[model samples]
Target: MEETISIKDIFKTLKKRWKLIMLLTLIAALISGSISYFLLTPVYQSSTQILVNQKQSKNQLDSTQIQSNIDMINTYSVIIKSPAILEKVIDVLELSQSVDQLSQKITITSQENSQVFSLMVQDSNPLRAVEIANAVSGTFQKEIKDIMNVDNVSILAKAELKENPTPVKPNPLMNIAIAVVIGLMAGIGLAFLLEYMDNTIKDEKDIETILDLPLLGAIQKISKVHNKG
Candidate 1:
């Protein structure tokens, strides 16, 4: 005969083994929390925005010139992070770091079909990240003008100290919460699977049904087996 599990059976199993599930969940949460707190490195980020303005219009009413300027700004964004730009940034800051080191910390991105450019910098130090971001943006604006012979770049926004810049990496509470949920699900699944696969007789009813016989004597298992020598 085929056996089936119902919601009632699931509820019974959970009721019977809730303690085990809770314990596993707590353990997982604690492990996750500890790892996040001790083993994770914190990263801070800052961003500055620059606007791409049309330096001039050969014909002040030329839409084509405006489009060309926007396209050039996109290309300039890529060049902003190139070694040439980063080298200048490092030199001006007098930062005791290599060009490659500066490059690692800075990123330049632009929105599609938009005139805004974003300079983002990440570092272990929050204040230093903001400083690097601002310095890179300022350096790019000045250098790009000279290189492209255009004067349309303008600072839209500067990175500011976050009164409450919540650290963006290694969220211990969130990690622990997720770990706890996963552990509870895994424990419950394992418990139900073990219960379903268990075919050994556990009660007198099971023995009677298996043997198709009348009730017989019952005995309890002893802590230690006795030898019949």
Candidate 2:
């Protein structure tokens, strides 16, 4: 016959192994917290904003023309992370790193249906990140006009040193919270699995039901010692 467990059985199993469940949950939370706190590197991000100033013509450009300009800007945004642009930034900052090394720290994104592009730089040093972001923006603005045949890329915002820059990854509290939830799920699953594997009768009712016979007696287990004189 097929076997199944009821909600009562689940509760009883949990009560039996509550201590082990709690310990595993706590251990998982601590391990996740420790890994997030010490094993992950903290990255600080700095971003600079530039607006596309397309010269409005007397004749209104079609939607296609406007979208083409936007598409062109997006293309330039990718090229901003290229070695050409980063090499300039490295030289201007006197950074002693290869172009590939420097490129890894930069990101370029833009707002949708808008003409503004944001250049974000991330590094262990917040100040260096800010400097790199601003420098790249300036360098790109100076050359983007010649490269893209457009004269309207202007800096709208400059990266500044944040008083309390926040790290971008490995959030410890959030990680621990996720770990605790996962641990609880694992504990509940393990509890049910062990309960499913146990076939011995745990109560008098189970014995009576299985054998279809009256339960003569059920004695509570006890431990005692008697001295013989």
- Each candidate structure's TM-score, on Cα atoms with residue i matched to residue i, is 0.77, 0.82
Overlapping backbone residue pairs in candidate 1 total 0
Per-model tally of clashing residue pairs: 0, 0
lDDT of 1 by residue, 195-225 (tens): 8888899799778978999886988877987
Write the residue-wise lDDT of candidate 2 on 1-229 in tens digits: 1234566666778999888788879989999999999998888899998887667776676776567667777788777877768888888999998888888888888778877888889898899999999999999888887777777778999999979989887688999999999888887787778777878997898798789999888789898989899
Worst 10 residues of 1 by lDDT: 1-10
Candidate 2 positional error at 128, Å = 1.4
In model 1, residue pairs whose N, Cα or C atoms come closer than 3 Å (at least 3 residues apart or on different chains), thus clashing, are: none
**Which runs in model 1 stand beyond 4 Å of their true positions?**
1-4, 57-61, 94-101, 196-199, 208-229
